[model samples]
Structure formats: C-alpha cells, structure tokens
Target: MTHVIDPAELKRWLSDGAEIAFLDVREHGQFGEGHPFLAIPAPYSRLEIDVPRLVPRRTTRIALIDGGDGVAARAAEALRDIGYTDVSVSRDGVQGWQAAGFTLFKGVNLPSKTFGELVEHALETPHLSASELSHRLDAGETIVILDGRPLQEFHKMSIPGAICCPNGELARRFWDLDISPETPVIINCAGRTRSIIGAQTLIDIGVPNPVYALENGTQGWYLQDLPLNHGQSQTYRQIDTPPAEAVLTRAEALANKSGVERVDSRTLDGWAHDADRTVFILDVRSPQETAADPVPGAIPAPGGQLIQATDQYVGTRGARLVIVDTDGVRAPVVASWLRRLGHEAYVAARTDLPAASHADETLPLLPEVQPADLFANGEPPRLIDLRSSASFRQGHIEGAEWSIRPRLRPEPNQTVVFIADDPAVAAIAARDISAERGAAFRLAGGPQDWEQAGLRVVATPDTPADDDRIDFLFFVHDRHDGNKAAARQYLEWETGLVAQLDADERKLFRLPGIA
Candidate 1:
C-alpha cells in the first residue's frame, strides 16, 4: 500500500507531529538542482544493492519521489516486491515541495531566513529601545526608563526619570519595581549586546512587560540632546552581594578554570531557530523539570545520566558542548567530566540568574541505533533518528542517514516518526518545534521501544560520496558503539567519509545542494 500526502499540507503535519518518510528517487544531478530536507538519496539504479540496505523496515509510510512520476513509480513497485507495505509517489516531486511554497533546505541548514523574515521564537523575550520609549514618553504614555548601565555609569549621566535599575540586577531587583506588563520597560547600556539581552531576558522568562533597548543606548539619549541626571544611581553594596560585573564575571572565570566554554545566549536563540544547530544541549535538571520546560533544543540527561552517557553521548567526541541546568549546579560537574574526556563544554547561561551555577549544557551528539538493525527488518514502517549530529557520526543504524538535530528536516505534510533515546525530551522539542509549520509525530517509545519490538541495529560504515541512484526510503535504522573499539572504528570511518566527500570530483555535480 502506498501512502500519499498533500505537499501544501506537509507543513501542517510537521507542525502537528506526523511520521511519514520522504524519499527523493531522482538522480544525483537532478537532486542537486533542488530537493526537500527529509529527502534521502537512494538512486533508483541501486535498487538491487542499496534499496534493501537503506530501507530495512517495510512497514513505514513511504513517499517514492523523483523528478517526475515515472522513476518514482518504478521504485515504489520494486519496494513492494521487497516487502515495502506502504509507499506513494509525489505528483510534483521536488517541484511540488516548491510549488507548495514550503522552504527547501539547501545547505546542512534547513530553509534559512529570508534575511528579515526569520521566525520569531516564543522561547525568547523581547526588548525595547530609547526611541520607542521617547515615542511613548512623548505621547504621554506610562513608561519606565529603566537605566540598565552600571552604578558608576548611571551616576555619570542618564535620561530624566530613568530609574537606576542596573542591567545586571533586573532579574532580581526588577521584581521590586512592580513593573506591569502593560507598562513598557526601556533598557539601556553604554551600548552593547548585554543591555539588549538584559531587556530581552526579562521578556524571555515570562516577564509580561513589553521591553525595548535605548536606541544608541545612553549615548543615544545624549545624542538626542536629552536631559541627563546624575548622583541618583541606586547602590546595592549594602546588600552584601557581588557587584553585577563580578557576578557575570564568575561564569567566565569559572569557565576559564573549568574549561567549560561559553556562548552568547541571545545568538544561540537565532541558531536554535534555523534548525542548523547540530550541537548537543544537555540540561542537568531532573527529568520532570526538563519535561516541564527547557531551552528549545536541549535534552534532559540529569547529572547521573550525563556522567554515564558522556563517551557515547556525542557531545564529548563529535560536536561542541553546551550546558544548562537548575541554577547551574550540575553543569560544572558535567563540564568537568567532559573536560577530563578532553571535550569542549560550554554553558548556555540563564540571563535570569545572577549566578551561572544554574546554567544548562548543550552539545551536538549523533543518533544511537545500529546499522544492521536497519536493514534486517526488510523495510522500516517509518523511520528517522532525532539525535544530535555528533551522535549520528559515531555509529548509527545501517542506511539511517544522519537526520538528527540540526540535520533532521521532515516535510511538513509527511508523518515523520522520530527515534530518540528519551521520548519525553523529544516530545518536548517536537511539541515546540513541530508546532512551527504544523504537522508532527512522536514515536511513542522512541528507538528503545523499536529495539524491543525485535528491530535490528547495525553500525553503518561510511557512505561513498557519489552513490547517487537512491531515494524514497521506508525505514531508517541505526546502531551505536559507545565503546573504545567502536569509537576507534568511527574515527577511522569519519576520516574516510570526510575524505571521500572532499576527494570526489563528481561530488560537486552529483548530490543535492544540501550540506
């Protein structure tokens, strides 16, 4: 039986959580011209050698796709002979995805921003600017000119009525102001990403107020020839706390000593939105807390699991590492472990906290499925692994393409069944991300559940760059060797995958334009 999906509705399915597999049967050259994110390469010419290898699970919902109906039809029929129970041909193929106005992925990154129209995420907070405040203030509107510069700077000069709410204390002290959401809060700095981020911080953490940056910042106010007040700055020295700079500096100083790196939380929000983030993001909080809410692309691997899963976890070996957790307590421990392993670990610090101890960890890891399991079952029902990219590189199910974090791009209309080790975490991410264009699905028990159902797993060998005659896969299987021997094998294999892709001359003209 073949499964059909409307191209226009695919976005909805992805947003809603459907697990249908999309395969591009077109030739490498044809695919290179343009193709969808979820489309895996299984050239029709390799039907005899590759089809069975790539699609071991026959029961999956499959879309046999090509430049037109002809090759897709042939591939679909052959898949049936080989026991593929569900498959269908897209009436328009790659063209159809385009016709639907659905963004197509070109690089390893998915449909990118159109310069300005990139998605504005719900997880992030908003900021206000001086111009905005001036406009509102001039309009006789109730607005709070919350001066966010340091006490020294505030005493030097600031806008009229601008309260001495230092940028650093907004998280803790702003609460004392009783600023309502309706009252817009203006944030300012000497001029930098911090004050901008500070205003944004309150906005991100459920602060109901509309906030803005002082355009041009404190300088902007002066440039506009506005009045400046001095000696009215608020001081927190009597509170017996570390100065704001010292508090923010602790994260860096500790990181320097601990080797846990750092990333701008604001910019991270942008990367998280693009779906090109292939890093592993770990939150050391309890499972329940992580489930309640988390940074968009982060996974919960409490300190215990994080310690246990490090080597095989991909964050240590493959990609960059980021850490976030409850009040940043567990992150240092986790970061210490990864550092001992000689990995780069970073903390995605929470803007709301003065101490970085509550920061979370995020790193890219590969999927955890064996290659043999993938091809053993004849054809998978519907398959895709949703782990980090670093995880995908170590070892994965045979024929299971690296489609995990920052790499797994399912069409909106297709029902994509995701395989994650933790269904709860995946469910959370799926809930947040899948709601984007609409259409999404959860695999219930994830890869573990699939394995329990007698699915086989294999450690996939490196794929050649120009094996161009494949597409329309039914099932994607994976296997991971978290041990030393497996890791050694992976090091050798990654060297090869990189070399072949780099060496092959035909590679340029052969594969789709995706990275």
Candidate 2:
C-alpha cells in the first residue's frame, strides 16, 4: 500500500537531516518549468529505469510529486513493484506544494546554479567580458581559453582555440599543460554557472597564472557577435602519470578547507550497512578511466558533470556521497565542490574499496516481430514510436504514432507494435498496455531495421506539435541554435536565480568564510 504525505510534511522531511528521495515524476518540460527546490526529475516515462540509478537503496524514503495528474500514484506503484520499500505520494502534487506557500523554482539544477551564483557573489571571482577578451585576442596577447563543458558540448561550439579541459580535470591536469605560469587563463561554459565555478576552481587551488571566467560564457561571446568554433576536438590529453606532489597537496588542502571527509573502505562499508542512511559510491573519473579500472558497485559520474548536474546522479537529498578515483587529485577536487554545494561528500581511493553487489534487474523480454513480417499481413500493425519527439520529428517509420508511457493508449483488440531506441521503455509501455489491452509486440531492431528492410520512412515536423514535446526543454535549447532572444532570456534567468531563492533555500549553501 502507498502512503500519502502532504506538502507541509514533505517540506519538513526535507529539512529533517534524513535521506529522502524527493522526486518530481512530471515530464522534463514540466519539471524544468517549476518544482520544489530539492525535487529531482524522475519522469513517469522512465521512472523504473532511472530509480535504480538515482536511488540505489530500495529502502530509501522516496516521496513522488506530480503536477496533480495522478502520475505520482502510478510511479509509486512502479517503484514498489521494483523492490522499493518506503515510498509515498505527495498529496495533490506540485499544486499542493504551491498551495502550502513553498516556492516552485524554475529551471533545472537549481541547487548547483544557485550555489554558483553565491560563489561568484561571495568570492568576487574575477571575470572578463566578451568584448574585452576579443580585443585581447586581436592584440596577440598570451592567453589560453579552457572550455569547462564536457567534450560533447564543446564539440558543438566553443571559443576559437579554447581547449576542452573540464573543471574537474583543471586542478589535476593544469601542471601537465605546456604553458608558462605567466600566461593568463580564462574558463568558460555555455552559461554563467559553470564558467564562474570553473574559474573559481582554479583560483581556489592557488594556480600561479592569472585566471578569469568569461563573463556569461559562450552566450556572452555570442551576444557580442563573436565567431564560435564548431566541431572542435582540442582537449587536454590524458596522462597516465600521477599528478605532481604540489598538485595533490593543493587538491587535498582545498578539500580540507571545505571540510570534506576522507574515508577508507572500512568507513564506506560501515555506512553501506547502515540501514538508516543512504550511501552512494560514485566513481568520479572519466568514463574511459572507470571502464578501464572498474570498481565494484561504483557508479561512473565524471567529476565536472557530477557537480554541474548533481540531481541527475543523486536523488536522495541527505545521502552520504563517497567519491572514488584512482588518483588522489580528482576525488578531492570534486568532493570540495560537492561539499560547498551542501552535500555530505567524502573522498576514498579506488584501491581501498571492497566489492559490493550491484543491481542487475533485467527488463522483461517482449514478443518481437520482424519488419518484413510486419507487412506480410496486408495491413500493417499500429506502430507506436516511443522515441524522443525531436527524433520523431526528424525521421520515423511511416504511419507510426509518437507517444510516451503516460499518454499511450491502445484498443484492447488492436495489434500495436512499439519502436524505441531503449528496449526498456518499450517493455514498460508494453507491460502497461498489456495489463489493460492484449499483448503487444516490439519492432525488431527498431526503425533502423525497418529502413534496412526497404520500408518507407517519413518526417513530420508538426506531428507531435510543440506543446506535446514534454520530454524536451525548449527554454535553454534554442540559445545554441542561433536564437539571440532565447540566449538573452536564458542568461537573464540564470543571473536572476539568486533573487528567487527564499531564506531557507539560501541557507543550503556553505561557502568559505560565510557562516
């Protein structure tokens, strides 16, 4: 049976110093528009698939919030079916929270973005305007630009000649860069938070070279009509050698300053066995590094992305985070930032961690029908495309209808076939449909299989329509697609995030020298 908690009770639970997975089960677009400050987006479409990764401890207290659409109750049932023990639904959902007078924040990554703004305000992190940087470049000044975003984002667009050195790797790899201490360095991201956080990261580590965040990052550069390099691959090279003693010392000192705990395997094991607390064993290294040296039960969360999008990885608000890495430098650096971000973060060596069991639940297999077989019976089966609306707009099997789990409905006698990139989504959707209707089959090998079979495909830009694309967030998406007005609006939203926070929300940040 599912329990029901009111918004006031949920709010109190969040501040009670207990691990609680306050999840918003609304779609990405709805969740991005507004949600409780501590709410993590676990859409109803991918609730089962994401819950295992977000809240590893099945017994962890979870409260599901929706947009008064009854999705939370459905999510609660799904979680219980997947071995989740303690789960509840927020009474009346987001509407209830607002009715209780709590703030519903706009935008994703509220905590990280707000903390970035607070860091800039408290530390007065120096920055350079786009026009100033442009003039300096024209003057042939010795300056280096480091793009703080991940390589994928950097590849899309970046400052000309900027190197992709994510903020997490800056402290560890700065000494490896063949640059003189005299050369000035500037760190930038797509917007304000990362640029400020990345630049301030270097300053906090006491780098000898002058450092500044590109004010407003790529958006700022674009607003100035400056050219951005596309399809760039320039990035910091990975070094097998351990960091220098000085670099390690700096990382350690910064972590200590932030009061990040240093724990060994024994402590981690004890915490893991503690039934009352939720502990996350995160391997904060590059994906390649983590794959090369796999740590048992460790979730791969690159350090930079972990800090920038903590909600994506961690769902429990007050859980203990044990960050692991092969080297001494990366974990400490990440833990320092996570500490400042108001998490109970710890650093541990990969060699010291003991093997632990990981979740291995497999999706139930669905009956598959070959693309050619789909056409053998003169009339084709009703095709339900479970892919993203954006992908559906780009191209899809002709006659297929795009739908997500929440909106999918098929007739009891209809022959429905699901086409999806992730088989799990199709499986879950099929399960739901089959419970009410008859059994449903999936397209063998998805749309690619249909294309290879000489089937007709079509593109319909207006098929799902903009309003129905709840999985996509168009608010900050258009900025990179040459929408100057959208870019300006995004920057304004980021800069104004601090003023939107209430007193309790502002108290979550723990900056240096600030009580």
Candidate 3:
C-alpha cells in the first residue's frame, strides 16, 4: 500500500533541494554492486533497526529502492509500521532509476569520493606517477612518503620508506615531520580519493614542503608491477606541543568559511536530554591515542574515515554532530568539512563530558546448541547460516540455507538455529527470530565450532550470482580467495569516478575557491 515515486520526480526533488532520505533497501553487498549516487544503504533486513537512527524525524521524505528485488515493497511497509509518516518506494526500484537514464554510482560514500574528484579538478592537485616516484626512490632522491591510510591498512602494504601520518594528524604533527621545506613530500592511499584529499589537506594547511599525491595510489603501484613492502609499521606519534597559533588561525578561518558552530559541555548535555534530537559526539583522534587515554561517551572515529564514510557513522542526515580532539586543530578542521556537507557540526574541547561504557558492553548470551547436540536432537532445528553468500558457498552445513540477519523469516513450527562468524551478530539474529517464531537458538561457537566438532560441510561448485542483493564487497586483498580480478575491477571503477562527477550536474560539493 505504499506510494510509488517515479525516478524523474525523485531527480527533480534532488535538484530542488528537497529534504529526503533516498535509501537503497538491498543488502549492503548488493547495494554496493551499483546504486543511485545519493542513495544510502538501508538494507531491507535491518530497516526497522536502522531507519530510526538514519532518518529520526517521522516526517522526513523516505524513498526505498531494491533494484527490482521485491524487497522495497516489504521495506516500505516496515517503515510505515514503525510510525514513519512519509514513505514511498521507487516505481521500479534501482532499475527504474537507471531506465530513466539517471546515473548509478557503484561504490559506497559517493559524496565523499565525488568531493575528492571535484577537489582534484578545481585545485589541480599535484601528483607523482608510480614510475616517476619509483625511479626517484631507486636513485635515492630526497623525498618523504607519507601514507594517508589508517595504521592497519599501512601495516598490510605500503611503498618502501612510507610513514603513516593518517589524515587530521598531518597538520597537528607538521613540525614533527622533521624535513626541510625543499623536500618533496608524497602521500598515498589504497586508491585515488584519499590520496587527493590528503595531499590537498597538507597544501591547505600551508606546509612549506612541495606536496604531491602518489598518482592513482597503491593500486597504481601494483598495476605498474612495482614492489610493495608488506608488514611495515612506521607510524607518527603526537608530540604534545601546545596547539600552534598559526594552525589555530587556519582552523578558525575554515570553520568561519563553512559557518561551523561551536558547542560547550553545557550545550552538549542539554542536547543529550532532548529525546527528539540525535546527537553524535565523536573523538577525532588516532586509534593509538584514543586507546591510551579514552574519552568517555565520545565514539572513536578518526577524522579521515569519518569524512570518507559519513553515512556509516552518522546515519541521520540532520542530526547534530559534535567533534572532539585533545588538540583544537583536528576538531575544527573536521567540523569545517562536515559543515560543507550540509551538517550542523560543532567543535568542542571539554574534559567534563559524560563517560560511556564500551560500545560492546551489554550483549545478551543466547541459548547455544552444540553442533553434535543439534545433529542428534529428536527433531533437528532448521539451520540458518548467517555468513556472507560467498562464504556460505565455500563451506556450510550440508542442509543449511544462507540467511541475512535482518531478513530472517522463521516458520512458526520450525525450531531455528542461527550461525555466524561473530557470536554477537548471531545472538541478535537469534533474538529477532525468536520474536517472530516461537523458538530460536544459536550455535555455540560458529562455523569453526561445527568443523572442530567433526561435522560434515560441503562446498558448492556453483558460484552464486550476486544478482538480487550483495551485503558486502570485500576488498580484493582482504578476500581469503585473493581475487586479483576484483582488485583490478575496483581500480577500474575508481578510475572512472572522476568522469562520472563531470557528467553529473546535480552534485553540490564545493571546495573553498574551486566552485
């Protein structure tokens, strides 16, 4: 009974600055395969759990799409059931949007990536190609390579002699860089976007060094058959110097340009008491720093990733964002970027904020049935494997059917048992299933437990087509199968993003002087 919106009208609404949540209700993996550029991931399975956090306001315009999977209709119903006042589905889902001749973005965080592209186009960010940089390194040129990716990513693989100076810390730790102004500094990421943004960040902060992004980044290096150093762990630590006056002035100017607001502890406390508003207080610092001396209640989200994947962290578009940093430099810079994205962001530095327990504090332990017990029961429970589709196909219990967490539909008479890699996800799936069906249980340990218990598992020869919905698009290097083809495809996809931005006339991203 949900109303349907035509793709043309939706596009018009976007062009008109309509306040709406355009959500793709397919699984995250499926959504990642291809989707409308602005469509946020709101998989049909977790609609009830995710929508409230994402939209918050009951009257917000909500448009659901499923790429013709038929999940959109069900998701639309669920939204209405949860008291959402305005809800509708795309006329033909994602296909409808495409059939209407609108652009469909292939990756998550399109806004951030598009912004990076715009930055490169407008500012003409400097770059050093893989071959050129490799030759310079071989000749022992006076250069410093700073990897802008996270420490974990840096640990996996990096160009030789690259130091980890993750975004946000670049300005704060500039003096610690310990290089002459004439030294050529290079920055890189897994791909192009972060490399462009990171290099531009240093340039904007007025670093005297001649900065350049490693053209096309690590993928470019791999494509050129260049060697990469694995298991490298060079990282820059904070020097704890008082915030420099010049850096503070730069942050203030940027904040003023973006019209970012400022908040105190009292204002934050008042917002926390408002039931109608959703506020996210985040600590924009390095993982090592946050771990050593944690801030209570403030979620740990490094500034770069927060900007790169804002949808993942802050679901509600109109929600208030409070950024925290021990040094004044990082928070204001992050707030400035958030403001550019049309968020009501505030920068604050206060030690009196309330403390919150760890995010994983209160997980309920579900009743678990051992694999041996499950097989020997009078009536074996219906096995529901909650692993990724790709993982399930690799090896699963002989009769187990692959299932997603939020979309599990247990039969009233069936005794269901949930299995997943993580016990926490499995426990939640069990609880949700039990709410609908009379009884549900979880496997004691997970798939590993089944194998250790000498249970028979079979691998399917057929590669399941990722047609209906894919929840995850595992990085090529991260995939246990080591799909070099996936890596190539990802690089190709990323390479084309700049051109896509050029064609899309609706994007509103603006760099300081570029727009």
In the range 337-370, model 3's lDDT, one tens digit per residue, is: 7776656788877574645523533455567788
What are the per-residue Cα lDDT tens digits for candidate 2 across 132-214? 99999999998999999989999999999899998888887877898789999999999988899899999989898999999
| Structural similarity to truth (TM-score) of each candidate | 0.26, 0.96, 0.86
Reference-based lDDT, each prediction: 0.48, 0.88, 0.76
**Least lDDT summed over 10 consecutive residues: which range in candidate 1?**
110-119
Q: What would you estimate as the lDDT of candidate 2? A: 0.88
- C-alpha RMSD in Å of predicted model 2 compared with the true structure: 1.7
Q: Find the number of clashing residue pairs for candidate 2.
A: 0
Prediction 3 TM-score vs. true: 0.86
Displacement of the residue 58 alpha carbon in candidate 2, Å: 1.2
Clashing pairs in model 2?
none
- What is the C-alpha lDDT profile of model 1 across 126-232, one tens digit per residue? 44545666777889998877765556667876677877655434544555565676987777654333344446545533457777655445554554555657677
Looking at candidate 3, the ten consecutive residues that score lowest on lDDT are: 474-483
Which is the better candidate, 1 or 3, if ranked by TM-score?
A: 3
